[model samples]
Target: MSTLGVNTGWRARAACRDHDPELFFPTAHSGPARAAQAAAAKRVCAGCPVREACLRFALAHLPHGVAGGLDEDERRAVRRRGAVGRPVARPGPRVLARRARAGGCSAAQVAMWLGVSTRTVHRWTAGGAA
Candidate 1:
């Protein structure tokens, strides 16, 4: 019963909780092993009651691995489709600097929050370039 309405206790009922963590995060060079592992993980996710919540969380924060019966690429596709009607504008350097100063966060933290790169945040913070 968090603010997100995701039951924390639901994790105890997850099938993959006791499994190897590596199975969920396959590398690009994994080849067949990746498919096999993703399938296995998806099977586990299929029976989880919090599957939707898991997917939403993955799309927002995890950014990698097989979650809620979908892989990273699948989640990325879902996000793209979800944003089809609404275009997101990138924050300007002044906005980034303001957020960093107000939150007392580092360039890397601000970059991650803005979905940019650490180098980009550095340039913005340093007033070098946009």
Candidate 2:
């Protein structure tokens, strides 16, 4: 059931429901502890059965948290690529390169597959950003 074009049922199944809200919304990037805090938040989201729903909700309503295992940058990347409802994992470089080459594609083309920047594809292909 939805009150305003949003189903509330998913909250019952969210992994962070019982966790501290601050865990998902670390306050500062400059702080040395922020990275570790975000990682801890993400670990909770990593196994969430409702991750997709959470991402969609985050994209629509929540602007500042680790919903669906993604931080602000990742969510921005998803939004910039017009993939509002679909959450996708980064493509493995070897597999993606083979497929890209098979299609006669470029790094930009590969980035399109995962809603990331061309630079991100390069990093992924270079064996980084997993």
- Whole-model Cα lDDT per candidate? 0.63, 0.70
TM-score between candidate 2 and the true structure: 0.62
| Candidate number with greatest TM-score | 2
List all candidate RMSDs to the true structure.
Answer: 15.2, 10.5
lDDT of 2 by residue, 1-130 (tens): 6746899689898889998888898876733245445656777887799988888877777778788878877788888999887646754445544445344456766565445788876665664222
Top candidate on lDDT is 2
* Model 1 C-alpha lDDT per residue in residues 1-130, reported as the tens digit of each score: 4535544565666677888987788764454345455655766776788776666667676678998667887777778878522332334546645555444566655565556788877666664332
TM-score of each: 0.52, 0.62
- For model 2, name the residue pairs that clash: none
